[model samples]
Target: MTTHLIDKIAWIHLADGRVLSTRSHGRDRYYLPGGKREAGESDLDTLVREAKEELTVDLDPFTATFLGEFRAQADAHPDGIEVRMRCYESAYQGRIQASAEIAEVVWLTYADRHLTSPVDQIIFDHLHDQGRL
Candidate 1:
């Protein structure tokens, strides 16, 4: 059996009970504004780079804090492929505009849960129950 394991990092940027999400080009579902780490990069490095590349924001490393980690079957991947998502709560600068492969950026609330991936749904549930989503 082949194991498809993906290690990814994500950001949970919240404001007024909504979370920031991005829709990549040619993708229907919305995801948090981060991605897989490059070789030899720390979580913080990946966070900074992905945020800029995808959302044109510069994440403030000093204000970063771990939120939670989640895992689920990878969407759009073959069976047996799983994704481990490590998330963080952090502050950022610069006006957030879609960059790179990102096509749109939106703020989502609990009512918008179905638009996200399985792992992101878990985050939405947690944040909603905590009065944040």
Candidate 2:
């Protein structure tokens, strides 16, 4: 089985203690605002770039803090593939408008994470356990 490291960022917007999230261009489920890292890109770089592309907002890389990493059997892709997600916390600039690969941006709470990916369920569990939810 070939394992792929799906490096990603959480891009949490802590406004009134709520987290911002979004859905992919053609998907119905909601997801954290981020995406897979490109070649030669650092985690922070991926976060900033993906955020800008998907949300049309610039991320403060310096303000990005490592959150937690998550691993789960790939649900969206084929079976037997593991996806490793590296999450992060960052402060964003400008209004979040869905631009590139995103459909709609929404602020989510712990209760609203049920529609997230399988791997994200684990991340949400951890965040809840850490009292960050």
Candidate 3:
């Protein structure tokens, strides 16, 4: 059997013990507001670009801090497929709103972990354990 990996990046914005999450158009689960890196793009570049595209905000690369990497079975994918998320926490400029493919923007607590993807649920657990959620 072959194991497949879906590499992705995510912005972990926390406020008042909740995390920022986004639901893409027609999608049922909310995800952190970031995406895969494009060719030749560094993690910061992908983070900034994805944040702008999805949430209408400019992430200050200078203020970005590495959170941690998380992996879990990719939601809706077959067995042996997993998603690896590199998460970062950063300061941003501008108000957040749904843009691009995003249909909704929400703040979720640990209790709302069921509303997110498998990888995001792991992230929620991590945050909760750290007393940040």
Error of 3 at 44 (Å): 0.7
Would you estimate the TM-scores of all the predictions?
A: 0.95, 0.88, 0.97
Query: Per lDDT, what order, best first?
Result: 3, 1, 2
Best by the TM-score measure: 3
Candidate that would win on lDDT: 3
lDDT (0 to 1) per candidate: 0.90, 0.79, 0.94
lDDT of 1 at 72: 85
- In angstroms, give how far residue 91 of model 3 lies from its true place: 0.6
Alpha-carbon lDDT of model 1? 0.90
Colliding pairs, model 1: none
The clash count of every prediction, one per candidate, is 0, 0, 0
- Candidate 3, residues 7-105, lDDT tens digits: the string is 899999999999999998888999989998899989899999999999989999999999999999998899899999999999999999999689889
lDDT of 2: 0.79
- What is the lDDT for 44 in model 2? 89
